[model samples]
Target: MVMVMVVMGETATPAHAEPAAAGSLEADGNDEVLTSKFTYYSGRTLADPSKTMIFSGNGNVPLAEDIAKYLGVSLGNMNVSSFADGECSIKVNENIRGKHVILVQSTCPPSVNDSLMELLLMISTMRRSSAKTITVVMPYCGYARSDMKRGRERSPIAARDIMTMIETMGADRLVCVDMHSGQMQGFLSPAVPSDNITAIKVGALYFAEKMVNVPDSASEDAPRRNVVVVAPDEKAVSRAKEFWNVLIEKGVPEARFAMVLRKPNLEEQERKEQPQSAAAVSATSVDTDPSTALEHEIVGDEEAIADCDAIIVQDIIDSGQSMSNAASALKAGGARNVYGFATHGLFSRDALERIDRAPLDHVVVSNTASHPIGYEDKPTDKITWISIAPLLAEVLRIISEKESLNPVFRLPKEQQ
Candidate 1:
């Protein structure tokens, strides 16, 4: 093969990492100030000397341009169109033989069709052209939720199938934002440089800023005190640890770190014996009943929720039925302020509307998953969005410099 990725726009050179203490991964003492990562390096988009191919999907055009502007390389030649026969058509306006071709696309909504078709065609075209290296940057990766097969006689794992498709199509490397699970990369070919990047630091900084504004919001006695990070489900415990580490680096005392043990929701017997429906219809309003609160019914542990004043929630996915149920439990238990922090905000089936109805004080999801349409603004709703552009741009810069990604998190946001 060949290396032909959808093009990521070329941008300016990355900065050098200053020297640090010895024997520390902190600093490798490697100082080589560089400009751009491309083998045919230059600053202007239309002026690069190398035959690099930079192509962008309609959704990812802006990001591709940002990355291109960051790498200081000229854009490659590409023309995408729809034929009269209702088939997507593409023409390579430039030669890419033995050249590194980069392709950029966002696998967001309409993911199955637009993302799949666009990426496949782009890769197949570059592969046929014998490009040297092909890298793909999917900022909002779709089909990621299908990372695992929960039921049946073992059909294809969606994530594996997708990676295989890309690999078979001629992708030498892969880059995507917060995957459903980071370990999913292991299923792909080892030769493929698959980087599953995250932006916990960005979230941590946002949390820090929020803490500074309200000193005693999440904690009382120690206003500057750190709060526990919680994973709503057992599957997300790993992310909770990663988020805790980032908080530590951001100045949260280690003693404050804790993971809420994820327990199963009430099963059939527990609900039947508890007089669940009776409580909803009697003694309280309709809103108090878990079954009537959202479209789906739920019963959570109020003890677990009320114990914590503030919680750093890991995710809000899977119809948000669980989150809403859990939120009700928290309100009953004792949590004063409940805040959710997730890399992806996949609010499905009227989830945003229901979340607004919950007692939660704040919910923050990155700009990674398109902000859930109208979630940016709503009456009686508090939702904040953080950008992962800096984090992703940093990864590209480090890859170009042949540097380790350890420093990527430490680099200041302004530099990223």
Candidate 2:
């Protein structure tokens, strides 16, 4: 049995004996007392603010700062530099002995490898320095897409390898946002608890606010502005359905669901099964551009999408080819205004320009990953960024309090 007392204000200390260490297990045959200045009654031992430290790597510093600010704490002092030969050098400038440490790092583009290495090194440093526990807050988990081997090729399961590395480096837990595949959690060892949270609710709330004031297109008794949530591919159908349900719950009266069916590229499929011979080499001569290789057609309740506003929901928007193609398909299927929403916006290699020229009216993505270079100079209103700091902070707080996280998976009461 355990008892946690939350004292308010600067009052006199209770008559109870000195509380045990933050993470120490006391077995004196009496109820354990876990009290602190910033403690609260959350049915578990909540993290004391003074003893909780937050650190960040080179990836997404702004996000880390926002999370710290939300939690009413300052970030820990940590210096990360590179050696003469490009080796990572990390130094934690604060004493984290027996303290709960949270490290914020996203393995994103422009420095994926470096960011990962820095995180691993930081975890090892904290473990060796006698930290009570280390929690890795990785908003964008790189290499998540390489989850499985393709066909019969002997390919490395990079996602599993990365998870193994993090766990081996002594991370107690991991928290990531919108992993490409939910199965990636299985890649981690059971010792390292992993949380794969979603930013779909955040995205849904943003769209709900934008569509709240939209007047009814028909009579007062008729449905409100016709809106359809679209899944760009078969894998995204579940996500799109979740987004659609949230929109309706948020008062989007006429929200509907649709999906873009992709035609299999027979030629490409045949080439993959062929051997690495001259014939296979010549077969690759065909245009392999994703945007033009395969065809897409919108399939769903036709009445729900005809002349209705379409919003494409996806996990990651890398290169913008699939998004552009999905938007074009929706427009061709009688969608008036096509929008795109994704959790991670990895706009690489002219993706922004391609989106600007595409049929999409607007695109919204969470700030899980930092924007690439030249993103600000791009002259287009098609891109919007929303922050996931509040959600992440809430999750961190729940974890610190050792409470059930089922609440975070649902839409907030206010939004509902």
Candidate 3:
């Protein structure tokens, strides 16, 4: 069998050629080349890097590069542009005939529709180009919060709609990071297998290291620190519990889990009940503004949380209201310090500023979605970013090797 590896910008490297070192190729504009060869290939049972090709949409190029580097392959050449009318146009610069294609894109805020369109176009183009298989790596699946019907309105399940579009467009598999609801996987076609991975373990390991130096109770021989994992809402209780479990396994002692209940906002409900004139209703208010829609109330064992450090865990942090409210409530309940961890940080509106002013001492988020340009230069001392590229790269490798992905659901030994 002949090996074929498509390198960005440069010509395809032959199988016998020596692999280039990772990060040796600088990404130059849209025509950058990033190529590397797999040094060891035992047999067909392992992933044939030559047959695999990875591409990135306009949404998150940096993350795609990181994953490609990890797999010892270059990102496939692709160009995504927009027409005068704002329609997306995708051009695959490489020949992907009979090759397994992986596309990395996150349907996130600010331009969710555009990002999603780019993904669909890429998938359709790959299918038309005779690609052997297509796997969509969407780090942040947009409209995931619309997994279920709400109220009595005849609303569409947008998540399901997006899934149908993807399946119809010819994607063979789907992968997401910390999907807002696990049930969303059922929305996809049965033939299209989906994996909803979590970043809770990643967040847990980060906190474990920070809290490792805390003192243990005098009565116990082993060192232990009192810590409480707080869920921002009832829906996030499972996430908080998962984080707590990992913390325990990572040698964090005396960990407890709690949930913050959202109190109904009577004022917001009344406003919704009142008929609104089309002229009065702004486009932004089409969805309920989370910042003013609910109040938070902490509920858990008082002795467990009082005077203990608190870590609020959730899937997404949009607007930062829920996180701020939970942290404020925890402090009022006598919690000594408060921290927050969210898988996706969609800092919409004034979220970053709100988080900076909130009572949370520190916050950690996974780099599932790309931040705005120039955000890196900002002095956001309370926020830290952790990359999920390694986890995603391993998943891609496993899929290419045709291995069961059950092991990836749990925290790795090193992380624990």
Candidate 4:
């Protein structure tokens, strides 16, 4: 729990020993001159500039910039450009020889190909330039959904392909926020070390603060307290459980858990009888196929949803179709308020519009994916953007110090 602060040319210990307070100004400046200090913890006894050089790819400059500021190091000078016919040019402008090179990039939306290519070029260039270690800090791992073959489709596993490219290009380690599947780790082993940090812990803490209003009669044994955690799909059940555990640890009243079960052709049957936008048709197209259906049912005690607050937990909200359906279903079931916690806000296409029209109160998402999809300046009440920047900065510090990332990778025993 040793917290270090990165001020200009000096190391100061944070009074509160909190890593998130890095770069926060202390209240010591008098009226004569206002002075502020930036604090950063390197997880080290001695600070050395040559030890680490962080670089920001074009995909996520803002996040990379925040990480750099947190680490008290400037982003390594690198020039990335495109040719007339859409070719990529990369130049490592700074000498990064013998430094632990950390590159931050997220392959998400609009131009996944370009983003991936830029990251690959950066890794290749840095490796050839003799960097000691190359770590790819990808908060949102694109193409991760294709980790395994689905229904004998003769398609290259895109997740494996991306990992292979990185391994072939000489990456020492890969740090991603959340892979679509935890099993994707098997693909990176023995060649490149990979860490998939889940944002559930981050989301749980956030919701605990906003979702603290509980019924007075609520008890640990009862555990339903007018709030219900909804798992949008089977894949998200584990994440929902994790979120609930963290919420309870954060002192929110005990909550109930439920899930959305995929009921077969009910929607198809409805479509034939009376077609009406197929249930809850969303205009958003994060990963559009234009053919996916939205038909799900609540699988717990039906009475639990009535007059209760519902928080839908999901990993990634791609088209937002499932989310829209879940919100509509919960509201139709008489749920009072519907909130959402999605780890990756791939708020593609017109997701904002869909979310606005849906019966959801607010959807909290992590900045695992970069801009255009996250932290928009335009005012919106349905979405709340949370930053994993502190979490990323903390992980980078642990990596730089050659320490275990388990502390950040998992919730503490108490929280868990």
User: How well does each candidate superpose onto the true structure, as a TM-score?
Assistant: 0.70, 0.82, 0.83, 0.80
List runs of model 4 lying over 4 Å from the truth.
1-46, 213-225, 266-295, 373-379, 413-416
Residue clash pairs of candidate 3: none
Root mean square deviation (Cα) for candidate 1: 10.3
- The lDDT per prediction is 0.58, 0.77, 0.76, 0.71
TM-score of 4: 0.80
* Candidate closer to the true structure by lDDT (higher is better), 3 or 4: 3
Model 3 spans > 4 angstroms off: 1-46, 212-223, 276-295, 377-379
Q: Is candidate 2 or candidate 4 better by lDDT?
A: 2
Which ten-residue region of model 1 has the weakest summed lDDT? 31-40
Stretches of candidate 2 exceeding 4 Å from the true structure = 1-47, 216-223, 270-294
Question: How high is the lDDT of residue 17 in model 1?
Answer: 31
Highest TM-score scorer: 3
Cα lDDT for residue 83, model 2?
Answer: 71
Cα lDDT tens digits for candidate 1, 175-253: 8876777767886788888887765556655564444223444355544532556666566667766766656665665
Model 2, range 1-416, lDDT digits (tens) per residue? 22111111221212332432322222122221212221121222235788788898888887787677667677788888887678888888789999999999999987899899989999999999999999999999999999999878899999999999999999999999988899989988889899999888777766776543255453557556678999999999888888888888878856888888878879968867867887666544422343552388778898777788889999998888788888878877788888888999888767887788788887878888888778766545567676677678778989987878988786656521
| RMSD each, Å | 10.3, 12.7, 8.2, 8.6
Q: Candidate 3 on 1-416: residue-level lDDT in tens?
A: 22222336322322232212221111222111211212111112225778988998877777787777767778898778877678788888889999999999999877899899989999999999999999999999999999888988789999999999999999999999998888989988789999998878867765676553245443547546578998888889899999999888877756888888878879868887788887656533323332432356778887877888889999998878788888877877788888898999888766787788788887778778887444566747677666676678878888888877776776544521
